[model samples]
Target: MAQGSSSPGDDAGNLDKTFREWQDDGSSEVATLGGVYGGANGVNHMVLNVRDMEKSHDFWTRVMRLEHCGTQGGPGQPRFLRFYRSHGHTHHDIALSPAKDPDSLPIPTGPLQTPGLNHFAWTYPDLETWKQQVRHVVDTGYPIQFRMEHGMSQSLYVRDPDGTVVEMMYEFPEERWNENIEAALEYRRVLDIDNDPDYFDPKPEDMPLFDENGLAEAS
Candidate 1:
């Protein structure tokens, strides 16, 4: 499509090295920072339309290290549904439901480029927990498709059984990015994750923030 108008899940493979800025399409509309109205509280859960519930259950638990709460319907039942949770927050963070017609769709072989759910991220409650999940993914030979140092947070992106992008990330202390969230959003550093021996550790120094004019400055 057009530069700066691409979705985050665009099929383009070289975004890691690309420097991007929002391109206005001549629309002057804007939304309130938080919201003029309260809006929905937050994304409580997501139910994915998956081809195989068992396979999806395996991958979701593998990447998220979530608790497989339970399953619903089976045997004489007409559908299969499974639920998973990360505790601390709510009863379930993700669930799986059978797709409308498994054979009608061509299974995606790469990152999703189509119009749909872009991606959903789950920020681990603690750093070690997040690293543990990353290590497990590497150890088990699950493909770690993308890695990014996003200033305030570092993330690893992996595809699930249905080729949906799921990001596992952990944020640094709020002090690191609260000062210049605008700069934080602009920061993008793609690192050689597996090659770097200490990739799981917090960056030695705080990430650089910038002034309103985009000049590098302290956090």
Candidate 2:
């Protein structure tokens, strides 16, 4: 533990041995940490800026199939906001309004649309049900930016009307990544939209273990 001394940080043999032991033990032998539950429940609603409300409505309603609850600016309400799933799914799953000077903003062009915000994910009940939505996107002629098999979920990176990357995905069971979440997070595999309808077909194994900073060497 002394300075300039041989330590785990300056060592590779110990780390490699542990990693190999993990691989030999199979996926079930993962380490986990129990956490204290806070009073927080979960994400209830969100509001975002859109280029066009009608176009956004088409994308969210038709593609995502979110139910439109109602909008503000009716009679007493002075706000012009379109609300989706105001109560059932959550207090308000999403609310949209037009963006101010949208043309002046930098266009979202990244695979995951990284400019202001990267992406936001919506969960599907299961993989099969999610696949149906993927097919719907294809049939609707929407472009799928990226298909990924993440350690915790299989996801489709897609564009909303404003070109924001909206991720539709379903998470794998806890047993898949309950242990060693960091290593599990590093597990990523590209999936084909056509051939890999169900990315979990073969299932992923041999998750890569990166150092805390994801350095090439175990620095």
**How many pairs of residues collide in model 2?**
0
Model 2, residue pairs in steric clash: none
Q: CA RMSD for every model?
A: 10.9, 13.0
C-alpha displacement of 219 in model 2, angstroms? 33
Give one digit per residue, the lDDT tens place, for model 1 in 48-156: 9888777887887765678888788863368767889988567888888888788887777665688878788989777788788777887878888877778677788
lDDT per prediction? Answer: 0.69, 0.66
Which residue runs does candidate 1 get wrong by more than 4 Å?
1-37, 210-219
Please report how far candidate 2 places residue 174 from its true position, in Å: 0.6
Determine which window of 10 residues in candidate 1 has minimal summed lDDT.
30-39
Query: Candidate 2 lDDT, tens digit per residue, 1-219?
Result: 111214535333344454455557674444221221121246677888877778899888988888898887742244678889723646579999777667886656655434356778998776677777777877888877888877677787888878778898867766566655776687788987568645434333332234444412211
